[model samples]
Target: MNSQFWDEKFSLNPNLYGEGPNEFLKEQLSIFAKGKILFPGEGEGRNALYAASLGWDVTALDQSYIAQKHTLLKAEDSGLKLHYLVCDVSHFIPEPESFDLIALIYFHLPLSIRDNVHQTFEKSIRKGGTILIEGFGKKQLKYSSGGPKNEEMLYDIHEIKSSFPNIQWEYEFDGIIHLNEGKGHSGDGHVVRLRGKIK
Candidate 1:
C-alpha cells in the first residue's frame, strides 16, 4: 500500500495498531543493550516508544502523517522523545552505519521495491548491528487475522535471506504464530521471524 492508503487507514481510528510494541520485538530486543535504533513503518510508534522508554535513542519512519502524529503523542504521554519522519521507504535515505539496531515488525512492501528497501536498511546499520523482523508468511492468506492479502507482499524464508545477503543470520524461522497486537491484528497467524547482524 502507498502513503495515502496508510494515511486513510490510520485516520480511521485513534490508534489503528495499538499503544504497545510488537510482542516479538519486545521479546527479542530485551536480549540486547540499549543504543541507537530505527523502526521502519512504525504505524503508531508502539515499538519506537517502547525502545525510547528503555533508554534507546529511537528513530522511526512512516509515510502516514497520521501515524507520525499518533507516535509523537504516545511519546509525549510516556515522557519520552523519538525522532519520527513522514516519508515512504522508497524515499527514505538512511545514513550509512548510523544505527546500532533496526526493527521491521510486520513491515511489508510491494515486490517491485522490497529488495531495494531492505538493502537500504541493511546499509544503515553499523557492522555488528542487528536487524529484527517479523512479518506475515506466504501462508497467511489462509487466515483472516491481518496482513496484506497479496502474496507478493507476504514474506518467506528465501525472500528474507536474499533481501539481506550481507547479514549473518542468528536465527530465522517460518511458521505459524499467534498475534495479538491490537484491534487491527488478533488471532493465530503464519509468520516469518528473522534476526541477524550485519556482516
Candidate 2:
C-alpha cells in the first residue's frame, strides 16, 4: 500500500468513511465486555474511538501519517485516548494472547501479505478472544461502494477461512448489504463478515 496515496486521500476528507462505527463492528462490540483491543488499518479511528468510549484499551494502526493525525484530532474531540501507530499491518504482529479483540473492518491489503497478516493477528488474541472482520467480497466489483478496486485485494470466504485456519467461527456472512458510511462508502455493497475465536 502506498502511504502517499492514503495520506492524500485521508487529508482531503474530514470524514472520509464517516464518523460512525461500522454497524457490524458496533453490534459485535455491544455484546462483549470491555478489554484491550486492536484495530489494524483503523483509518480515521471511528472503530477505535468507539471501543475507547466503551472503556476498552484501544490501539490502532494505519500506514498513513495523515490518517494518524486525523484520528488523533477526533480522539481529542471525544476526550478519548488511543494508541495509534503509523505502519503497515504486515509489519505489526502484536504480542501473542495480548488482545481481547482484533477488529479488521474494511481493511484491505495486498495479496502478498494478506494471509500472513491474518494468521499473525489470529494468534495475537487471548484464549477465547475474538477476531472480528468485515471486508468487501469478490463480488464487490459490481458495486460502487468503498473498497479496493483490485480484485486480489478483496475478500473471499474460503481464502479468509484458510488464512485463519484455527479459528472456531461464531458467525460468518458473505453477501450483499446496504452501506451508508459517509462520502467514502455508500449504496449497496457485497461484503464478507466474520466473528471467530481461537479453537
Candidate 3:
C-alpha cells in the first residue's frame, strides 16, 4: 500500500491496529537491555510507544501521516518520547549500523522489492544486533483473519531465512498461532516468527 492508501485507512479507523504492541514483539523485547531500536511500518505507534516506555530510544517510520499523528498523540499522553517519520519504506534510508535492534511486525511488502527492503533493514542494524519479526505465513490465505490475501505478499520460513542470509537465527517458526492483538487482528492465524542476530 502507498501513503494515500494507508493514510485513508488510518484516518478512517481510530485504532486500526489497536493500542498494544504485538504479543511476539513484547515478549522478545523484554529480555533485551534497552537500546536504540527501529520500527518500520509501525502503524499507530503501539510498539514504538511500548519500547519508549521500556527506555529504548525508539524510531518509528510509516507512510501515513494520520498514523504518525495518532502515534505522537499516544506518546504525549503517556509522557514518552518517540521519533516518528512519515515516509514510504522505499524512500526511507536509515543510517548504516545505527540501531541495536529492528522490529518488523506484519510489515509485508510487494515481492518485487521485498529483498531490497530487507537488505536495507540488515544494514540499518549494528553487527550482532537483533531482529524480531512476526508476519503472516503463506498459509494464512486459508483463514479469514488479518494479513494480505495475496500469496506473493505473504511469507514463508525459507523465504525469510534467505532474505537475511547474514543473520544467525536463534529461533525460526512457521505454524498456526492464536492472535488477540486488538480489533485489527483477532483469531487463529498462520504466521512465521523469526528471531535472529546480525552476523
Candidate 4:
C-alpha cells in the first residue's frame, strides 16, 4: 500500500488504527532492560512510545511521514519522548554495537531486504543485548488476521535460526494469540515470537 492509502485510512473521522502496542509486545516487555532500543518499521510508534514510557531511549523508523506524525502525536499525548524518522528500512544503517534491545514486531520485509536487515540487526546489537521479534508465522496463512499475504514475508523458526546464526535463541515458538491492539490488527492471529541474546 502507498502513503495515500494509509493517510486516507488514518484521516477517517475516527482513528484507523487505535492506540496501544501489539499484545505480544506487551507480553514481551517484562524482559526489557534499560537501554537504547530500535524499532524498525515502527508504524504509528505504539511500541516505541510504550518503551519510552518505561525509560528506554527509543528510535522509531518508518517510511511514512504521516505515520511518523501520528506517532509523534501519540507520544505527545502520552507525555513520552520518542525519536522518529521517515526512512526506508533498506537504507537504514545503525552504528555497530549500539543497541541494547532491537525490536522487530510485525515488520515484514521483502526477501531482497531481509538479509540486509538481519545483518544490520546482528551487527548493531551490543554484546549481551537482546532482540525481541514477533510476526506472522508461516501458519498464519490459514488465518485471515492482518499480515502480509506473501508467505515469504512470514517467518518460521528454522528461517530465523538460520538467518541469525550468531544469536543464541532464548526462545522461539508459534502460537495463536488474541490480538486486541487496533483496527490494523485485531483478532486471533498466528504468530512467531522469538527472543535471542547476542552472543
Clashes of each: 0, 0, 0, 0
TM-score of each: 0.97, 0.98, 0.98, 0.91
Query: Which stretches of candidate 4 lie above 4 Å from their native place?
Result: 1-9, 12-17
Better of 1 and 3 by lDDT: 3
Candidate 1 vs candidate 4: the TM-score winner is 1
Model 4 Cα lDDT, one tens digit per residue, 97-184: 9999889888888887787789888899999998888998888888776788889989887887678877999888788887766776
RMSD vs true structure, all candidates: 0.9, 0.8, 0.8, 1.9
After TM-score superposition, the amount by which residue 154's alpha carbon in candidate 4 deviates from its true location, in angstroms, is 1.1
Model 1: per-residue Cα lDDT over 13-32, one tens digit each: 76767778888898998999
- Shift in Å, residue 175, candidate 3: 0.6
Task: Rank candidates by lDDT, best first.
Answer: 3, 2, 1, 4
Model 3 lowest lDDT segment of ten:
10-19
Between prediction 1 and prediction 2, the one with superior lDDT is 2
As a whole number from 0 to 100, the lDDT of residue 117 in candidate 4 is 84
lDDT of each: 0.90, 0.91, 0.91, 0.81
Which residue pairs show backbone clashes in model 2?
Answer: none
List model 3 lDDT by residue over 72-102, tens digit each. Answer: 9989999999999988798788899999999
